[model samples]
Target: MDIIGFLKSQFLCHLFISYVFIGTGLIINLIQLFTLPLWPLNKQLYRKINCRLAYCVSSQLVMLLEWWSGTDCTLYTDLTNYSKYGKENAIVILNHNFEIDFLCGWNFCERFGLLGSSKVLAKKELSYVPVIGWMWYFLEIVFCKRKWEEDRKTVVQGLQNLRDYPEHFWFLIHCEGTRFTEKKHEISMQVAEAKGLPKLKYHLLPRTKGFAVTVQSLRNVSKKFYTEGRRSMSAVYDSTLNFRNNENPTLLGVLNGKKYHADLYVRRIPLEEIPEDDQECAQWLHKLYQEKDSFQEEYYKTGTYPGTAIVPARRPWTLLNWLFWASLLSYPLCKGLANMISSGSYLTLTVFALLMVIVSVGVRRMIGVTEIDRGSTYGNNENKKKQP
Candidate 1:
């Protein structure tokens, strides 16, 4: 291995990285806590402050995918609406496939200047997790319990709350509701069959009620008050992502500095173009997924989606933000390591070895969290449970 690859493979380097990420994440979360008071005083200023703080936290993961692993994420998009990518509010639809799909999503958000303010309709259980989850609460990321009866009100209120959000953010949605697996796909198609829906070859049936609610809340807003001038329009970023050579990527692969090239095909659709009525909206969403399946089929055959492909300019902010954290957090960690070594003490060295083993296990658990096998059982038997 070369010097860089050898360094990346070192236990000490991984330790330093994990320490910096978790350490700075906790620190930023603490700072986010102080913004609660600012929320009541000046909500917009509070939002702006939280945006930058959230950037400091989320960009680290983006750094892992883009900078450390050196993965290339290319965008295939309409050149006409390309300039407006980072300038407007959008509801982004993404495929839930690979373990590192969200990391790739974060990579695009970083490039588009939306990393700090990107939102997602994540599961409510994630709200309790440390670091990213806690930081997301301040960013106003919408969370759901996956029950239509309970989540309808929560999801509606969440999307409605973003009416006058200060930053141009992307509210990302994975309508499939969980990462794809052969078993999940098997059951998902059974549900699709029960509903008299066509079988999908590439994706599971999309959950539509939350999407319908999101559209009504953000789509038809009456002339709203100004946040960078009052044009009440929200667009849909219909995005389909796939990897080159059909590579199944994982967070572990990324952490170990393995690179994967990703291609994301996006089409910008105006919310006005979609039906406003809930039932109609749901139908529109299902049809959109059908089209998305076709896109995936094309990608599988041609290794490209149908589009005028263009790569957006990569910004240096992710790298810079990571460097800033590493510089700040590494000093104390390295100094202690140096002192421990120079002392020539077995006890301290033994303790360090044990700590490495513990961290290795912790890292494995973290990677396991992103594995497809560990994904939620939301739709695996929903149709059967509803039946006799």
Candidate 2:
């Protein structure tokens, strides 16, 4: 193994990287806060700058996935449609089966040059997390409390504002609504059977309301949601992602330099083809997920997505971006530690070490949230009201 790669895999190196990520991220958040006044001066310009700023912090994790851990991301799709990926806005509906799936999605966005500006329909709690969450606030990422009654107006207005987004973005939706687990899947399948819907072998029952809200009215809910002049999504990218058979990669696994292969199968459907009625739209999503389940089954059998694989070369910029941050931040950290040690201040060193331990704990907790096995059980409750 390469010495540097081995060094990066070490626990101390991971700690340093985490420190730099959180520290620089907090600084970036401050800079983002200062830009709030500029929004009134030139909203488009403010947004454009925030996109790049967000990219600076977000891409660190992307680099960790793509470069540090050396995860391979393969895109499976027609060669003809490949040219359009980063050029237009898209709604990406992906299976929620893995802990690091969102990072994988970010990797794709990074490859296509959209990491900074990409959006997601994330849980409301994420909007308050330290670095990543605060950055999403500036990126116009929509957050939902998972209660449609409370989220409908907020979600609609957020979607409406995307009509004037300054850059091309891919809005991601984990339509299964929660990550997959055997227990959750069992409950989800029960709901599927209860509703007389087809059982999904590899995924949870999709919460239809998010997709339903996108295309049409949520009957008996918010009829006004399908507004005049509401911006249409450019297209729907039905994305099915899977790790190589027998490999289940986690965020912790990636940080530990466990390389894994990811295959993403994408099928783009035009906006006009999706039905405008809520019920029809729900049906469409259900059928799409069923097809996705079949793809997963075939993948486990064949070890690849069902198409010609188009794996993009990992770009130097992600590595360069990460190195830039490390160089910019590490010198002061090392120098301060050296000074403290040389001065023989045991108290200062002890306090600093304790602080580092605290930061590490926080980072570990952040990683914990991304693990699907430990993920929030949003859609598994049998008694909870079903979404449209």
Question: TM-scores of all models?
Answer: 0.94, 0.93
lDDT tens digits, residues 61-140, model 1? 88888878988988998888898998988888999999998888888788889989889998888788888789999889
Worst 10 residues of 2 by lDDT: 217-226
- In model 2, the runs with Cα more than 4 Å from the true position are 1-5, 216-232, 383-388
What lDDT does each candidate get?
0.85, 0.83
User: Compared with the true structure, what per-residue lDDT tens digits does model 2 show for residues 1-388?
Assistant: 7887688678788788888898879988999999999888988889889999999898998888888788998899988878889987788888888888989999889889988889888888888987889998987888889889999989988876776667788888888877888888888887889999999999888888888775442111222433532234568889999988688888888888889988999988877788887788889889998899999999999888777799887778878877888888889888889888888888888878897898789779868888776877655456466544
Judged by whole-model lDDT over C-alpha atoms, candidate 2 comes out at: 0.83
lDDT of 2 at 189: 83
TM-score of 2: 0.93
Model 2 lDDT at residue 145: 91
- TM-score of candidate 1 against the unseen true structure: 0.94
Residue 121 accuracy (lDDT) in model 2: 86
Task: State in Å the error of residue 286, model 2.
Answer: 0.5
